[model samples]
Target chain A: MSTKELCIHLTELHAKSLLNDNDTFLFDCDGVLWNFPHIFTGAVELLNYLTEQGKRLFFVTNNSTTTQDDYAKRFNDIGYKAKPEQIICTAWLTAQHLKSINFKGKCYVLGMQSMKDELEREGFQICGGIGPDPVPSDSNAVTVDTLELEKDVDCVISAFDLHISYIKILKAATYLNRPNVLFIATNDDASHPQNDEIVKPGNYNAK
Target chain B: MSTKELCIHLTELHAKSLLNDNDTFLFDCDGVLWNFPHIFTGAVELLNYLTEQGKRLFFVTNNSTTTQDDYAKRFNDIGYKAKPEQIICTAWLTAQHLKSINFKGKCYVLGMQSMKDELEREGFQICGGIGPDPVPSDSNAVTVDTLELEKDVDCVISAFDLHISYIKILKAATYLNRPNVLFIATNDDASHPQNDEIVKPGNYNAK
Candidate 1:
């Protein structure tokens, strides 16, 4: 039988049992919970129903550009009263992973302000991720001396960024050349989805 | 059948398949990895064997008095090369939970310096957890006016502390009485273990 036909034949009791058996519900924020730029219809009602049933709700997503606070504010503005702790984004995960590993060195990053803010809040020393953009004239040549890099950097973190640059990539690559330097990416999405079109993501080539 | 008699013998192939089925292995640090001050016999050899087999390792524990960095240092000192990110203590989890929830208000904490450091590193505004001890003369009686509190606190975090005080408890309790306040505990461990002895742990009274 076709998959669609099988789904239509599922018993209501079995569906109810599936929901009743689980005390916690973990929803993927993007796509499943809501499409970007707007929340899906009945999503709010479904969340309310789960809460009324005393099921713990968690929003898990890979969108690393927004901090938990930013996500919480957006949720509230979009009519979902989500607490910050209930939202687990990749940005927070990256920070947690770094902290858990006891990384104590400076980091060269390729991402946006949200990723930077999350890492910084976790007491990570971050550079080359977000801030004033490097001018095209800043680089004299394609080749950069290894000595030119700020010393003692031991980590290179790559995340989604609209402002990713060759300079940022060069810095990240340079730091990653050291065997001791750790390299991390929030997710491995080579293309970003926007308004129903896919385009090469900025972090795609960031080492 | 007797409990021991009920055990079924497994073939070497089955044991090998079980080991080969997974790429990661998680070990509890305190009892399994190390018995307090010393590493257990064969623990190092077992870890070496796992690493040789290309298995990923993680150390999970509930000791919240130390940060990941501290734990890593101890691991290194004990001849096990461990990354800080491999350690997941309750202190780090507490901080991660608070940050994920986007808790922006001040926190009244009842924890040790490590917990305070971890939370403070996450940019939490914390007080009443670790600092100068409350003077006995400062309190005329057990009762304290609500106005005496540093207002606007919206979180009360409880973790293990070596210097827990009545003043800290009162302050944490007062902040917790607010309807909007968030209360969090690292774990439900009522007593702390040291050198094979369990003693009354800090955070025993904070609800």
Candidate 2:
């Protein structure tokens, strides 16, 4: 078939057929629902319509800097009804995954406080994510021989870390060098959109 | 030739023949001349003997934290005759390469002060290599929107950075996203030997 024939326009008839064909819908948050502070037009109405129809709706996002509860609150604040269970962000998913795997050791996180909070909510001991672990003023002072690495760290989780430092990277790398230590990254996006002219580095660049 | 025949033992006859065959010798620092603080037993003697024979010698190292002059001092401290001209370390090489390319733009470095000094010696403007660029006290305070990026950074150099931080990584990635920005990495080693029991993360791990 030609490309034109294969394309399906989302007309009112097609929308009705699509809604009837699917019992659940998954929506990405960043570009679809809203772009930061401004919610997209008609997005809340569509979500309410889906909810009224008793359809399952999930707001999935790769953003790990925000927790599931925060996302739900954001959705609610923007006139869309959302529950924590309906939000599946990376921070929540990472915690869930570790909990599912029965991870019981200390985690060294290269991420924001949101990720740490989510992991702590799952009853995991955490370190290295809350603030900056800068190298000493004397650059030569903090060498690998001088670094005090925690022996019990069993996992290194990399997400959107604004406080990522050489010391943090060193600790994570040392922990990950062990044979059994697990390495997990929330997302591998090259760049994150900030505003019109600015973009931020993602976990991929940090790695 | 057979594998066994290809191997040449450094016997008296073979040593003489090999010395006559090559007018220059390139040596690596870590495992060859010394293993930090202790010079190998015969390494200095061999270097001196080579120098007496008028054989040109170069000490090449992937270590970027030490400048050419520093390496020469290290060699002299270890009782080996050496000069700054005989050292071809990554820091020196990186500076030489940039100079060769006639690059006059400012550099955003993810490296040590040694690399910065080397670059400065070449008369290039530098930033981000001296100390820690920590995130703000509040985790949510520093976002991409608030980051003040330098507009004239035309190059990003990645080496052995003890002060590698999220702010530095963000700046490097942002600068690198431009099509004309050059990204340079000194070495891609996975790990560096610290002591008998510890291994440090290399530039590859940081990348």
Q: By lDDT, who's the top model here?
A: 2
| Tens digit per residue, CA lDDT, model 2, A154-191 | 88998887777767766787777788989899998867
What's candidate 2's DockQ score?
A: 0.53
Candidate 1 stretches greater than 4 Å from native: A1-11, A135-148, A197-202, A205-207, B1-207
lDDT of 1 at A175: 68
Taking the tens digit of each residue's C-alpha lDDT, what string does model 1 give over B17-136? 868898998888866677556688978887778878888988888877788888889888877788889989888888899889888888887766778878888998886666434424
Q: Which candidate is the best by DockQ?
A: 2
lDDT of 1 by residue, A103-177 (tens): 898888777678888999999998565642332332222232232466677888877755543345546655676
Clashing pairs in 2: A207-B207
lDDT for residue B105 in candidate 1, whole number 0-100: 85
TM-score of chain A of each: 0.84, 0.88
Give the C-alpha lDDT of model 1.
0.70
User: How far does residue B164 in candidate 1 sit from its true spot (Å)?
Assistant: 56
lDDT of 2 at B26: 97
What DockQ values do the models have? 0.01, 0.53
Docking class of 2: medium
